[model samples]
Target: MRLSTDSPSINDSKSSNKHNANELAPRPTSIKDTGIQESVLLELMLKHLLSGGVLTKAQLVNKMGITGGIIQELFDKAKGLAWVENRQSSAEGHMRFALSEAGDRYAKQASMKSGYRGLVPVPLAQYSKICRLQSSRRNPITFEMLQNGLKALVLPNDLLHKIGPALNSSRPVLIYGPPGTGKSYLCRNLNATLGDSVLIPYAIAIGTEVIQVYDPQLHHAVDNNNESAQLDLVQGHDPRWIECKRPLRITGGELTAEMLEVQFDSHSRTYMAPIQLKANNGILLLDDLGRQRISAKQLFNRWIIPMEERRDFLSMQSGEHFEIPFELILLFSTNLNPNELVDDAFLRRLGYKIHFDALDEPLYRKIWFQVCEEQGLSCSEEMFQHLVNDYHHLLEKPLIPCYPRDLLGIMGDQISFMELKPVVTKALIAEAWSIYFVQA
Candidate 1:
């Protein structure tokens, strides 16, 4: 069945899929580390060496069929990734760089992993190859980039910092907390921290002449004709790929095997890459891991192969299978037991599974103030004590007034309607509680 272009949605719901279940079963470690570019570069060097250990600089250039600058760049890179030794020939007194044993072994392993049977012949048309190679290694999000990409509310600094590094540097992170505790907020902000370069806000395809935004939901022209059609068209995107930047994408509960699989677009006549596929080189935060209609165990099961191999399988509607860069910081946020969500077997494979317990009292206090200042309310010690003693302590709430602030927000709005003073009183607080809090 066909799915929506922006997110995965089916016109029919006959075929269902499992999402999250049995946390402790230890998910099959869908922890595929992205190292495609490195493998390619290593193979390039290996081919250069397999022919002969002693090629002159000119021969090396001609063999790889690349320019001098490219050769030197590859040479320098080889020196770092592969072991090389220099020897002076007694006959000609020229330096020859040859792969060390470790380098040879590494090259072979890299070649095998990349599905390269032998060496790829150097061709000028290989430019697309380089771009695709870069796609996997590319950084999809960055720190400053995050600041510009969000419309959702930002969570506390502590929460952001606690889970931020794991988004890129660590493995799949599990963010667990009760509902309305800002779990989704953290996921939304992930787009902001993605590297700006991968954001590709806009692009004018060399073939089409039409300017297209890097926006995945919109851009579909992949050929010269489409580009040409789009070129004369108005609605030229701003901050084009060269300028526009949005790398991270958040998916709450729309993840599916089909989303993980490939779909051929009859309209576009091309394969519509899945969300995670597009998330390559960026963060793909799976918000509400356990709340999906799909079963947790089944979702974990689908991801098992990808986690272990750091690569995933995608099948066309015609049943043709292919692989793509699963290079993304996959984050799973849940309030349910991590063990209950997945089997222990599945959980162990996850790179880093961190459970975010309830926020402590002091942190709760700090966040409450943040809510006050942003909402423009004058909160005094008397007011604060009244809250802790009269309401917060009595209700045994999470202390930060996550819901309390929401209620107060309503009161603040009423203030605008009634023209009351900004300094909120117990009456205002009571009004907020009535509107926001769910009484037992």
Candidate 2:
């Protein structure tokens, strides 16, 4: 079986293999490769020392993902300042250094200012540069690539044609359709088709303040451990950057305007990069568009300038404003009509407005059989015809793609309860339909 490049198991196995000397060459051998200031390194060193009384130079290198030479250089500087002292010789013949009283006092001050004690953050300038380098525009998705990406889904040929060009437009898409027509599902699958991975920063440093960007919940780290290790041997990536599958984030009715701005965590003395920033190199999907707590007009107006300029302005607590790349595939999914939610001005901003209508009889029947096959239940042509001609046509109920899967699940439950064999019979389906739909 083929494993995805982003699989952690694959990455771990690769990382475990011995690497060639030239391959090892890519690993960060100096502070410059880390893309962090020396002062920040020094502060990080001090903070790390606070954990254990003493640490060998090698330990510091592993903890900080820095080179030995750089760690030694920082250690010498700290020793010169009377911040650290060689406490004892270790079994490996390396001297273990402990923080001096002065160093301990300095570390306390550093901790008070910002409690961040992880791998060093890349400077905002460096992060912005990296973002530009990995910008989504540079890699235009082709129709063939999208076809391969969504090959698993049973998408119609016409819809596939529409999706291909919509993705190429590099503008926000509005997928308006009735509920259960797979608007959100299609957007999600489109994200899967984006192909290669991009690196995302754990956090970014803007002057003294740090904005955390890597969201554990959102960012999926690629496991190509061997490849990453080999890559490091030849040329090291900044430790601050994580190798991740391009993010595809979705927010629904619960979304609010406040979420669009930089969220400052006073307790941590740091900031959380908003959803848009986190989705910089990926797709940002606003599912259920008109249903947000904030009005659809409010959201549309807020995005107008940014969408036009292809850049976003974010502010820190100090009111310092900066422009960040708005390089992402923006998607808006809604069951509500776009005409009702957005006017011509806002509509113009949306590149492709695709509509998903209720499924027709033939497609609905195919999906019914597909669902029955998946559920390990025998498909009955007689029963399927009964549903279409009796339950649906008789009642004037439109065919929804989701009904097969949902009705099948309901039927499965009833079958289990009554201790009957799992099969789609006309009687069984009728009973499930009665339970599924009630008089309003």
Candidate 3:
């Protein structure tokens, strides 16, 4: 089922309204509107000048992601303080500015305080407001949407119904089942069902401390080279806020308790937002749930408040506590028994606990044929019957969704290495199966 490119329906008016509300962060006209102290802005400008060496007004504007007026205002302030001097005019009649000795000293001092010289950060209050607004306006996921998004997978309709409601509820979901039953795969593709975008700031400011929020590796920027984006720019859209697809972060066995806290880099002298913070207004999948370095109970305790209250409290290096909106879909997928991981009380708190069991014969065969088609290999009915009756049934191995794709992959690799024709034979299937599973 292909995603419909049709326009949104009338029922999505609330989502449309919220989208409009968060579509753009209005450009700040003055230092007051920037939600940053003038001294801080000046120090940042000085640092930029010291690093970049002789910057034009337009260049500073581009570098700082602010308007030319603000840059000129800072330049005037810096000139008055003897921290900046205007150089001779260029061929384009634009006066270049460089930091004087005193300005250089001030910049070095500022760098000692904090090395953040990137885009001006959004105020923490404003960032929290936008996160809550976007989360509140998420469009309700319909069955049609879920079906279309997951059409490639061989999932049962009953499971889809459960998943659709769980996704719309904006609560924690526990997907537990046997290994390789497509649990993680389903969670990964859930982002495709959103089909919506959110505004992500480059960084956020709390007091004098700066915490970078946008990660180029995690946040994929949406193409904004269209008419609407042009209109937004003309209408004073904030360049510091990037339009991006709803983020999807997945962490498996590598997860640690330290990762849940705000991280500080001594070299950069700036705080890095945690995974949950970056995954706001999107999805965060804790795959391989019980396999983390942290115990299940300890992990549950860490998330207890965030899961129930829908807000997370994080701490800074200076013992300051702040709250951030926990506006994301939390998904936990595990191969272990759910009861073994957490207690009944904890399970009761989850919105939905859906089990992903082994596939029945018909579904398994469908996936097998689908894999065969994808691998460009022909599987005759006789071969298929031989695989099912002799390999799986005789050995009492359950039909798993990943088996077809993985076994075929192994067979394809063997064929390529041996310089044999690309065909699915009983011998090839037997060899792949033997190599795939250990016989007791």
- Candidate 3 matches the true fold with a TM-score of 0.93
Poorest 10 consecutive residues by lDDT, candidate 3? 224-233
| Reference-based TM-score of each model | 0.56, 0.88, 0.93
RMSD of each candidate relative to the true structure: 19.5, 4.6, 3.6
Candidate 3 deviant stretches above 4 angstroms: 1-24, 224-233
The numbered model that scores best in lDDT is 3
Could you tell me how far off, in angstroms, the CA of residue 159 lies in candidate 1 after the best superposition?
5.7
Writing each residue's lDDT as its tens digit, candidate 1 over 1-440 gives: 11111223332211211110111111111111111244354465564675467555445544432333444556677777656655565356645667778877875555443322221222212212322433422433333334444424444455544554565453566777677676666676654444232322222111111112134453322221112212111222211112213346676676665665554444433344566655555566777787675677887888887666657666555455555445556778887788888888888878776655456666666666777888888878788678777887887766532654676688789899889888878888888777777776
- Tell me which of candidates 1 and 2 scores higher on lDDT: 2
Clashing pairs in 3: none
lDDT of candidate 3 vs native?
A: 0.84
Predicted candidate 1, C-alpha RMSD: 19.5
Q: What are the runs in model 2 whose C-alpha is more than 4 Å off?
A: 1-28, 90-94, 224-235
Give the alpha carbon lDDT tens digit for every residue of 240-266 in model 2: 567777899899999999999999777
By summed lDDT, which 10 consecutive residues of candidate 2 come out lowest? 16-25
TM-score of 1: 0.56
lDDT of 3 by residue, 316-431 (tens): 99989999999999999999999999899899888799999888888999999999999988888889889989988988888989999999999999999998888899889988
Considering summed lDDT, which 10 consecutive residues are worst modelled in model 1? 17-26
